[model samples]
Target chain A: MTPDQILTPILDWLDLAGVAVFALTGALVAARLNQTFVTMAFFALVTGVGGGTVRDLLIGAPVFWMQDPWVASVCFGVALIAWFTPQRWWEGDGIEYADAAGLAAYAVLGSAKAFAFGVALVPAAVMGVVTGCVGGIIRDLVAGRPSIIMRPELYVTAAAFGATLCVIGLSLRIEQTVVWSVAALAGFTLRAAAIRFGWA
Target chain B: MTPDQILTPILDWLDLAGVAVFALTGALVAARLNQTFVTMAFFALVTGVGGGTVRDLLIGAPVFWMQDPWVASVCFGVALIAWFTPQRWWEGDGIEYADAAGLAAYAVLGSAKAFAFGVALVPAAVMGVVTGCVGGIIRDLVAGRPSIIMRPELYVTAAAFGATLCVIGLSLRIEQTVVWSVAALAGFTLRAAAIRFGWA
Candidate 1:
């Protein structure tokens, strides 16, 4: 089936790449908390896909990771890099900007998947929110730190706005690349704004 | 009709109490991470019901938390407690033991629910493990910490052992209380042992 025809995209390539990016974000955060290498890998894997798994389960879709090996494999690779070079990747690395990028990626990916699964508009929007937020939610709870949801930051709001716009665009059958680009930009803009203004 | 006669457990007060206990553990852990009130509540809700949600999805049972508002209410209560008395409840006194107790309660609760949903031995065992571990996994990732699953720790092992004993007792036609006692004790013992011996 064409990628357009697929509901839950096994984004043969982007999915793998997405996993690496999200895992890197997860691993870097865990490293900052002083976790062991094994712990870092676990966090990366869980954070990278936690939201997607929940969305899949809610929609009665096959759990995404169980359907493919690449998700786990990519996370492993990301973890190895993080463990070997935390200082290079995490410390003094404009991490806030990196995290903002990761958030934008997560928002777009989550929105796209939920829409594909035949979730209703509101629920799809919710799923997108969940997908973007849940991994960090899990990470913070385990690390015993404040999570994004608790902070008045723009994290979830940014994701929601992007997801809503994406859903609206898809409903109107707008061009896919155009819809994605707009959503991604909106997410980035909101996150950047929050960070710059030191919004709570 | 017996408790298992109807698949939905809406009237089961024990289940409500069970969710409260589950949320308590989540809240306690979140509090340790210094999460804000909202994050603590969200964590509590997810932690309390996360295992069952995963079990239901895998086994084709209805996700219990979505159908019940009591679980959410209970989690709110736990979050309130954790937030209002963060130091006392999560850090000030005897919090480690509280954590152990929470682990024991959830392990048994998860296993019994799995059995009631007609899961077989291995899947039920897996469900037990999932229930015990997933909330903590999410908690760690969101907190920017490493998850327990990646650790050489005894957490999953202990939960599995407890779940196994619970299943065994059920097969042997033991009393519910007897089985629960056995399972909770087994879980607590293993966890305590791990904490004491520094086992991963």
Candidate 2:
């Protein structure tokens, strides 16, 4: 397959992974609310898709989901899983791991999309910041907690660091895969460590 | 008064009124969630402030709340009222009116801010739509419901009409109070009429 063909599928997977992880966090929050299964699924779907939609609209791009139905499909599929699965799987002690994954995945995807759109480095980084945190911000606000903006563990800062690194790596002509892997790792690691140590 | 003095107080009152109205809705939602009064207040403050913060950041302006404490103060005052008042006042009897007020106030402020930032007509309209809708969008997401985006309604369309009128009024050299009064009236009228009659 040509490079153009390869790029589309790779980007799709990254976006899908981001959506799935966000869905998990949404489902978890809904469960915490003791919401019904349908509500849980709906929350997960919105949380999964919300950030990217905002990003596309801001950048004047056709909304990604409207163009490629796969993104919505992934969210729908995750909602089904979250609905049908036994509560124990999500509610178990390992929930933090899933939260960390969601954070990292969305951050990197946000940065990548910005880079793809040729946004300036700073604005791109801000896009990454918004993408990574806004969903969770919305989640916590409705759930009636102080937003992560009020938290001390450097949530947006971590996303910024990873996004900057990815952008720099791309500018320096590094391999795309390597840049994304490193960026995602950076975000995931910071979140994982923070959760483990109760840093926030 | 010079432009700075004249505009500052005007912007402040708009922000205050908008914040209070949005805060009322947030607090009302929290009350419905069976959250404690403190939680309700916190949601009120966040929802009242979140859209403005996001809008400022997007437009490369100082976030209005951080620059002035009065916005937060008004939000708290509104939250107190929301909390101390009887639940039935909001839960059934007054929610529609409060929501209509919110929809109007925020939409006008958002559009005005966009024009102040020198955004063009299309982007400005986009700003108005986002300004009017995003607060509720964020609030509903956090509260876990189908947001404006998912709803079949004239929510955005109403904001568009009001925002467009504001821009056109400005272009035609309409007086400032006249401009905002018309915009707010248009937004409220559109929203209330639609909600009351189940008009889409």
Candidate 3:
């Protein structure tokens, strides 16, 4: 099998995993605001797919969620979970760590997809950052809160680092698995440290 | 010339007109909030292109702004205009009237594009509404204000009227110019009336 054939399934699974976690955060935010279930679902759907949609558009690919029923189902399932769970169940650094995992995985996935679509490396890295951050921006906007971008968190930068590393590793013909794993780990480390230390 | 060839330039022109107005509103909002020039430009670019960007993504078209420099230039120009103008210059119903005009034109343009792309009629109309209103939604979100969609107004309804009418007319094989003009007129009238009467 070609390298692409081998990598595609793994990337697809990673994409869905990232979507589920991001959708959870979106629904959790809506629950915190006491929004209705409909709102929660909308938040989940948009947050889960928003970044990928933008990435696909920029790369001239079909929007991913529209092509796959599974993506939307994952978002809806996660939304239901967040809606049914007690808010206290999600309180702590655990959710933040999960979000960091999603961010790093998504950043790598976004860059990899862009490169597969023949995007230049730099723009692909930028697409990675966009994919990781845009969903939260949309969620905050809909929820009428100050967006995460407005905060001085190291969120976007972490995604950028992961994406850039992935792009560089791929360009150097590194093993795909090792490149992705290391890149995601680097991003997660930065984010986890930020959360633990309350870094601006 | 083919029908598409004949229509492309006209539609492009209308798209730019819509972008200019939406960008102006975005920049004006930033100005009202006393934001810097950079914020004004960011707001203008995002608001001006946000709706059409969504439409293009959903339909699998190349993102419009990235393919055309004129769109971004117009957005920047409008932002500069808003930034330099005195606050009083944009006061009263004039900007509202301009926004109404843009809403009508963009709604028709968005629906027409969707139809041309072979989207189903109902989804095409919905695309029109999305194209006309999403820019302001993003602008409001970035500015940390309640979006127009949440307000008690005829805003989205007006865009829907124009989009639905355009789709129905095209489906019935009406002349393109007449269909678009009539649809835009209907939307403008509704929005204008809403602005004048403060309709919810």
True contacts kept of each: 0.16, 0.02, 0.26
| Residue A134's lDDT in candidate 1 | 84
DockQ (0 to 1) for model 3: 0.17
Tell me the DockQ of each model, to 2 decimals.
Answer: 0.12, 0.04, 0.17
lDDT of candidate 1 over A1-200, digit per residue (tens): 73345634534454565566667778877787776665676678777777767767776665666535367667868889888873674665366776776677667767777777677878877777777778788766666668878887788898888888888888789987788789878887898888888766
Q: What is the lDDT of residue B184 in candidate 1?
A: 80
- lDDT tens readout by residue for model 3, A1-200: 64357656887798899999899899999898999998999999899888888787787866777867799999999889888889999989898999999999999999888777766665667678778888988888778788776566778778878998998999899988899999999989998898999986
Ten contiguous residues with the weakest lDDT in model 3 chain A: A1-10
Residue-pair clashes per candidate: 19, 1, 3
Error of 3 at A148 (Å): 1.9
RMSD of 1: 8.6
TM-score for all models, in order of appearance:
0.57, 0.55, 0.63
How far residue B138's Cα lies from its native spot in candidate 2, in Å, is: 1.5
Question: Can you write out model 2's per-residue Cα lDDT over B25-75, one digit (the tens) per residue?
Answer: 888888888888778878888878877776665555667888686888877
Q: Tell me the chain A TM-score of model 2.
A: 0.85
The TM-score between candidate 2 and the true structure equals: 0.55
Better model by lDDT, 1 or 2?
2
- Fraction of native contacts, model 1: 0.16
